[model samples]
Target: MSETIRLPHKPDAPLSYQFVPGQGPLSTTHLIVYLNGLIAPQSGWRATIDHLRRRWDEGGSRSANHPALLTYDRYGQGGSARDPADDQHGGSHDIREVVADLHVLAQEIRRTKMIKDADASNEDDGAAAADQVPKPKLIFVANSIGCVIGRFYAQTYPGSTAALLFLDSNIANSDQVSLFPDPDAPGFDPHVLLPPDSTVADLRRTRAGYAAHFHPSAPNPEHLDRRNIISLLPLSDGPPLRGAEPDEGTGPRITVVGHDWATFAEEGLRGSMNVPEGLTNRYVNPPWAAYNEGLARLTSADRARGPVIATGCGHFIQKDDPALVAELTDDLLRNIEADSAA
Candidate 1:
């Protein structure tokens, strides 16, 4: 069954979420909270949640248990809270708020009572059914900037999460080559990465260029930056990129990797749009250093184990290859189950 509800947050700051409860193994539920990339709320992948819910059912066949999952639109991106008025440059510059909202939302869901079986007179069976209801553990799945939010959440609320599945996501502190910082300067470039500080006419022109080069239909072109650069690409035209596959054997905490860089030409296109030339050199030369440090800190012990390159797909791996996303989701749940058993 599916239902939409608003989370009790700031009166103006409402969150939108879709709930899909899994059948079969009542005791084992997979609670997946996805932090979508930069795509608009009404886009293809947003609609693809229906398919993901169905895939959860398909994956249940192999499971030693059952699962339930939920997906929510983050504030500013979907039907959730609007961007804060103070942050005109970017309402959500501080991602910790997003993490806090997620935590609160999870607590709300856990507190709600599951519907009683129609036949309440089942006696002992009802007791078993009540006991079987899984105490949901959150599995945060995010891409691009969403990964940054997820990273902070894991670090802040270490024990609350069951596992994390970063799909083509930016690892916290990996030495991966990134267009985020300048190679020569080795730091973030405000002008190149963020919109250049210029006149309205010039900003419009830059925004147009971003729309043309980035995603043809960007809601707010001025919002483009190193953080969300990957989320804007359209998925309709890209070649099929192999995605992260499911593994029944592994535990829930996992990092499934994929890239939308396709070939050097595509990389150049992406480079032209957001990354500074210096950062590009750093990205290509060392290939890992520029992006690995934060990723390393976010992951520790058994939780930190992936850089599984998904070739052919660009930054929007979920849209580029939904199959991979579905596979990774399944694998993550399994891995979490395995970890609990250990």
Candidate 2:
């Protein structure tokens, strides 16, 4: 069942969420929340979430043996009310505001009793279930800009998250200009590197359109300075940063996933922006990998793995590789179980 939550400060913006109880005890204390990319709705997670739910149901319902799952629409996206502060960002909200709302949503998800499907067919009203969710550990499955939002939330509210899965993280330091070749830069030459079909005019036009409307907040409803976030959460080598509170153990479990270069290269053409293959491979791929590398470094060496390239996947890892996404989450679930048993 879908539920609406009203945050105390912003009562005008009600968020809608859909939750399902795993095949565990109704009293389960662990929760998994999936976050959508900036422009996506919660429905973007349907394939992946449905896969995990089926896997849990295989052994039959076990009352709350597994963690409950939650996914919601942020204000100005999906089923949630449009951000009342949309005009404040020139028709969008910034990452800070978005994270602030998530902090409230996280608390509410634990404090309020939300109606959810108990099994494939049964429904339970959450009216009397708040006690079961107190300070419950959270595992966040985040993609693209959602990954940044998750990190900001965990940083502000330490000891709340248990595991994090980052899917093809956005390049936090990109200036919206460096992803492609500069047709106007010094010593620019169209003949040396340009492909046979990719004209100089085509490349220049795309870059202009992208610069005017894409980065930070082009057509997107969320405005964020990609470069600013990295400053807020610098790489491991930059300084000794502390995201988790002191008493909290060695940060949350981190898994980084990057899109396969070939797949993403192909997918890029499917859109209106027909970036030349040579440029995508030469100019776009390297920096994105480096950015994902930085994301992996956000945690300690022992706690992180991969910028695990998702083969046959593009930017939407969950959609392109649903089983892989579920499998990764399942592994994290085991870690949560082990922690709980301890």
List, residue by residue over 149-179, the lDDT tens digit for candidate 2.
7777777677777778999876766655557
lDDT of 1: 0.50
lDDT of 1 by residue, 12-33 (tens): 6566666555443333344666
TM-score of every prediction relative to native? 0.63, 0.84
Best by TM-score: 2
Which ranges in model 2 have alpha carbons more than 4 Å from their true place? 22-28, 60-64, 87-91, 114-133, 189-199, 222-247
Worst 10-residue lDDT window, candidate 1: 236-245
Error of 1 at 115 (Å): 7.1
Candidate 2 local distance difference test against the native: 0.71
